[model samples]
Target: MKLYYMPGACSLSPHIVLRELGLPFELERVDTKSGKTERGADFRALNPKGYVPVLQLDDGRTLTEGPAIVQYLADLAPEARLAPPNGSFERAQLQAWLNYVTSELHKSVGSLFNPSMPAEWRQATQQAIGARFDYLSSRLAGGGFLTGPRFTVADAYLFVVLSWTSHVGLDLARWPALKAFVDRVAARPAVQAALRAEGLA
Candidate 1:
C-alpha cells in the first residue's frame, strides 16, 4: 500500500494507524498546491478530489477520505483493535465519534485556515468550535479514549484534528482534557514515527 499525504494534515491519522497496525506501506508526499505527488505524478489522476490521505492498495485500488481509510486499515488488522468489529454497537459508537470529528470538529477548525475568511465569520467559527470542544472536554474528562479505555481509529482522527488548534491560533489549553489527549496520543510510538516521517516531530 502507498499513502499519499501532506505533512501534518489529516492524512496523518491514517498514517499513524498504518504504523500502529505494523502494516507495510510506502509514503508519497503530496504538494497540495501543485496537485502533484513527490514523484511528480498528477495527484488528480489518483484522486480527483485533489486531497491528501489517498491510500493505494496492493492491487492498485485507491481509498479516499481519512475516516474511511483509517477504518479500512484497522479492519485489515483487527487484532490491533484500533476499531471495533463491524455491525456492533461499539463500532457504531466509534463511527459516531468519527463523524463528529470530521463533520463538526474538523470542518469548523479547518475553516479558520482560510486567510480570506471574514473576521466576523472567523469569530463565529471559533465560537462554534469552542462549544464542540466543551462537549469533547466533558466526554474525555474521565481519562480514556473517545469510545472507551482502548484507543481506536476515532482517537487517531480526533488527535489529528485537535493538533490543528495551535496552527489556527486556537489554544487547546482552554480544553484541558483535549490538550492531555493530544499529549497522550503524541507519546505513542506509532504516532511519533508518523510525525517524524512527515517532518512534523
Candidate 2:
C-alpha cells in the first residue's frame, strides 16, 4: 500500500494507524499547491478531489477520506482491535464519533484556516468550536479514549483534528480533558513515529 500525504494534515490519522497496525506501506509526499507529488506525479490523477490521505492498495485500488481509510486499515488487522467489528453496536458508536469529528469539529476548525474569512465569522466559528469542545471535554472527562477505555480509529481521527487547534490559534488549554487526551495520544509510539516521519515532531 502507498499513502499519499501532506505533512501534518488529516492524512496523519491513517498514517498513524498504519504504523499502529504494523502494516507495510510506502509514503509519498504531496505538494497540494503544485498539484504534484514528491515523485512529480500529478496528484489529481490519483485523487481528483485534490486532497491528501489517498491510500493506494496492493491491487492498485485507491481509498480516499481519512475516516474511511483508517477504518479500512483497521479492519485489515482485527486482532489489533483498533476498531470494533462491523455491524456491531460498538462499531456504530465509533462511527458516530467519527462523523461528529469530521462533520462538526473538523469543518468548524477548518473554516478558520481561510484567511479571507471575515472577523465576525471567525469569532462565531470559534465560539461554535468551543461549544463542541465543551461537549468533548465532558465526554472525555473519564480520561479514557472516546467510546471506551481502549483506543480505536475514532481516537486517531479525534487526535489529528485536535492537533490542529494550535495551528488555528485555538488553545486546547481551555479544555483540560481534550488537552490531556492529546498528550496521551501523542505519547503513543505509533503516533510519535508518524509525527517524526511527517517532520512534525
Candidate 3:
C-alpha cells in the first residue's frame, strides 16, 4: 500500500493509524500545492479530488476522506480496539462522533487556514467552531478522552484538529480538557513516531 500524504495535515490521522496498526505500507509524499507526488507524477491523475491522505491499497483500491480511511484501517485491526465492533451500538456511537469530527471540526479548520475566504464567512466559521469546541470541552470535562475512558478514533481526529490551534491562533488555554487531551495524545509513541517521520517532532 502507498499512502499519499502531507505531514502535519489531517492526513496525520491515517498516518498515525497505519503506524498503530503496524501495517506494512509505504509513504508517498504529496506536494499539495503542486498537485504532484514525490515521483513527479500529477496527483490529479491519481485522485481527481487532488487531496492528501489518499491511501492506495495493495489490492489496487484508493481510499480518501479522513474518517472513512481511519475506520477502515481500524476495522483491519479490531483487536487494537481503536474502534468498537462493527455492528454494535458502541460502533455506531463512535461513528457518530467520528462524523462530528469530520464534518464539523475538521472542515471548519480549513476556513481558518484559507486567507482567500471571505471575512464574514471566516468569522462565522470561527464562531461555529468555537461553539463546537465548547461542546467538546464540556463533554471532555469528565476527563479520559473524547468518548470517555479509552482513546478511540474520535480522540485521534480531535488531536489532529486541536494541534492546529497553533496555526489558527485558536486559544487552547480556554479549554482545559482539550489542552490536556492534546498533551496526552502527543505523548503517545505512535503519535511521536508520526511527528518524527514528518520532521515536526
The runs of at least 3 residues in candidate 3 whose Cα sits more than 4 Å from the true structure, single-residue gaps closed, are none
> Which of candidates 2 and 3 reaches a greater TM-score?
2
Question: Between candidates 1 and 3, which one is better according to lDDT?
Answer: 1
Local accuracy of candidate 3 as per-residue lDDT tens digits, 1-60 = 888989889889988888888888898899978998999989988889988889888887
Ten residues in sequence with the least summed lDDT for candidate 2: 105-114
Residues 1-201 of candidate 2: C-alpha lDDT, one tens digit per residue: 999999888999999999999999999999999999999999999999999899999899999999999999999999999999999999999999999999999889988889999999999999999999999999999898999899998999899999999999899988999999999999999999999999999
What Cα-based lDDT does every candidate model obtain?
A: 0.94, 0.95, 0.87
Write candidate 1's Cα lDDT for 1-201 as tens digits.
999999989999999999999999999999989999989999999999999889999999999999999999999999999999999999999999999999999889998899999999999999999999999999999888998899999999999999999999899888999999999999999999999999998
Local distance difference test, candidate 2: 0.95
Displacement of the residue 123 alpha carbon in candidate 3, Å: 2.6
Show the colliding residue pairs in model 2: none
Q: On lDDT, who's better, 2 or 3? A: 2
Off-target runs (Cα >4 Å) in candidate 2 are none
